[model samples]
Target: MYEIELLINGRPFRGAAEARTTLADFLRHTLRLTGTHLGCEHGVCGACTVLVDGVSARSCLMLAVQADGAIVETVEGLAEHDGTLHPLQQAFRDAHGLQCGFCTPGMLMTLVELLRETPHPSEDEVRDAISGNICRCTGYQSIVDATLAVAGAAGTEGSEP
Candidate 1:
């Protein structure tokens, strides 16, 4: 067992993280923050996407110890402190970005990162941002709309095509 210290959504987490535990397993199984799902288990799927110091990355591809001392944010951590939905999450609801909800968590988390870089992403950019993520249920049109709506809500237009 390895002791790993990480800040998750501003909460300090320090404990015995099994040496073999992936960050995804640590967040979901150990921490009980199950919003980060294990889809492909490979880095390609992006289903385990989470923010490590404000950037999106595949949690399953990393060891729990690798996240030590890192600031990690999961889908559960995406809400405002006052409990209001983040604008992107609101846009997703307004635009029906989710169908099965399996990919929603990762998509939402990835959107946070994507929007930070491109507040108003064009439809194509939105698609490209989440290209690593796979959604078997929704066809992605609504997700694109949702992301675009967030960009519009933010009063910033991303790269225009």
Candidate 2:
């Protein structure tokens, strides 16, 4: 087993995993951070998306050892410690962007990276940013609308969690 250390969601985490273990598996099984769901483990489904050093990454495609010493952000970190929702999350809820919710975490993390890079993205940009993330429900219009809503409201200033 290889020991890996990561700064996750602002907290430090350490765990041991086989060298072949995917980061998603390490996060879910070893770290007990089930928010990083696994679907289409081949990395096609974005359900396992997370932020590694502020960039969106497919956790299933990355090994735990590969992510060692990296800063990771999962869906569980999007909300405030006081139970307040992040603007994007709140917008998603208000706009009904989620249905089955399987893709919400990936969608959120992807948009988080987009907003951080482009604070006010156009509708096309929002759509492009989430193109890789597939949502079986909601038809994606709601998700685009929700991201636009957050961009409009906060200009995404200080939106980083």
**lDDT winner:** 2
Error of 2 at 14 (Å): 0.6
Which numbered prediction scores highest in TM-score against the true structure? 2
Mark the regions of model 1 whose C-alpha exceeds 4 Å error after superposition. Answer: 156-161
Query: Cα lDDT for residue 139, model 1?
Result: 90
Residue 91 in candidate 2 has what lDDT? 95
Deviation (Å) of 7 in candidate 1: 0.5
Tell me the tens digit of each residue's lDDT in model 1 across 1-161. Answer: 99888999889987778788999999988888898988989887788999998899999999999999999989888788898987778878888888788998889888888877776678888899889889987798999988887788667543421
What would you estimate as the lDDT of candidate 1?
0.85
Candidate 2, 11-35: lDDT as tens digits = 9999999999999999999999999
Model 2 poorest ten-residue lDDT run = 152-161
Residue 39 Cα positional deviation in candidate 2, in Å, after optimal superposition: 1.1
